[model samples]
Target: MSDITLPSTPNKLSRYEITGYILIAAGAIVLFWGIIMFDLVTLIATGANEEVGIVFGEFGEFIGGIVGSLWALAGVFLFFATLTYQKREFELQRIELHKTQKIFQQQNFSTLYISFLNKHNDIINSLTAYDINKSEWSGTNFFVFFQEKVLSSFTQKVRTKEESAKTPELLHSFFKDYFIYHFSFYQTSLNPYLKNLSVLIKLIQRYRAETQDAGEYYSFITKAGFTQSELFLIYHVARYQLLVEFHNIDHAFDVFEDLKDELKVDRIVQQELNDENYL
Candidate 1:
């Protein structure tokens, strides 16, 4: 079989190469000056021939002239070297910045995926405790009710899966049908430990991962054993807290903070449930 080929990214100049080039340019300048100085010294030795003292003085003068010329040549090379190297340095800097940004963006997506998995596991744990069998909500009035009550209220913000139908109508229809129909055989029962606050917080987190389309959040809440009343209560609480603290800020910091705090409570609930099951 032929060797598998990998896609290639752009080649950037290495840091070592950049440094080496700079050093070479500096050495060149020094060498250029040395040549000028040596020529001047030779001229002085040959030209001054009267008395030994006068000859020595002329030689010294010649050496001085050579030194001065070398210095000027070195200075000019150093100036151009700085300009050329600076442009290369800037290019390397830009490449590094882009690399850092790409890493951050990838990390952000990974974080979202992990968060969603955690919520999915929590839902499974709650269902297990209640012994509520999952029921298929697809093709039933239950799905219609979910669409009317939940999907209608929530907003959607992301479309990660390209193949999945993602329109407002299709999204509502897909999630409502998927959640209800997928695990329809499980017994429907409420979780004993999860309060409205917990449900609300989980919904908000789900929203962060995707959109809080009314249909999806409500489906998650109900499927996880929360009642419609619980959903409404948490929504109001989140809204009221926002009004009091955020005032008129376009950003929803209160909702985010509340979710962070509620996650703590959910952990406690999970611990208790774990202990009870073990006992």
Candidate 2:
């Protein structure tokens, strides 16, 4: 599973809610005190002179009543406003919690373990046949091979400006066939690394569908809290495996670039490429 930590409960109050509560409390207390004071004064004046008391009492009641009612109304408004704010806060928290849980579930180890197990024999056979040490192969080597064999060859027919007009259609067809061919290859070979690559691509596609907005999708992944090295490892491994699968390298590279740009980690990817001796 990813090392990402789940979000903790927030102690902070919703925006303007603290201020609203304070205002409501203060208004209620002041209103209550004013009403009590008016009642006490009226009673004392009635004992002195009935007629004068009645006039003073009625006048005081009218002014005090209006003031108290206004205060009570204001308090009520603030109370409801505060409640609305709290409700919105709760909704936001719930969404964040759901997202975090989904991320955890997606990153669970069982999926990767199963994928690895399924491809164990293929991994061993490939290693034995090629007599290649895994450590000797780097992302740079994979990228170089992809550029030369996949991208160059795929675009070779569109060499002239007029032919370039059909470049988009050609590129579309290339990716379509690329995915179809690789899907079959991976199914037969059961290459664990390629399987992982396929999984990552599907995950991204699912997220994009859910979010519907590129910015939001980017933010969601960034907030999932993957470390720089972890991000590099994911992109690197997936890119290399895609190249090995003879998939659309340019399209895959675009996805890689988009992720790095969204996460503000372009430098990290660049550093990895720089460190690769195969470049």
**Candidate maximizing lDDT:** 2
What's each prediction's TM-score? 0.29, 0.36
What is candidate 2's local distance difference test score? 0.46
Residue-level lDDT tens digits of model 1 in 1-279: 122233333385444455555555655565566546445456556655455456456545654565445555656655665666677677777767766765685477456545654664455344422112554343123323433333323323223334343444554444434334422333242222223334444544455455323443333433354343333323333333322322322132233323322222233223323446433
Q: Give the TM-score of candidate 2.
A: 0.36
**Tens digit per residue, CA lDDT, model 2, 212-254:** 4344343344324333323443454344454454355335325
Ten-residue region with minimum lDDT total, candidate 2: 128-137
Error of 2 at 26 (Å): 9.6
The number of residue pairs in model 2 that clash at the backbone is 0
Which regions of candidate 1 deviate over 4 angstroms?
1-52, 79-83, 90-94, 117-279
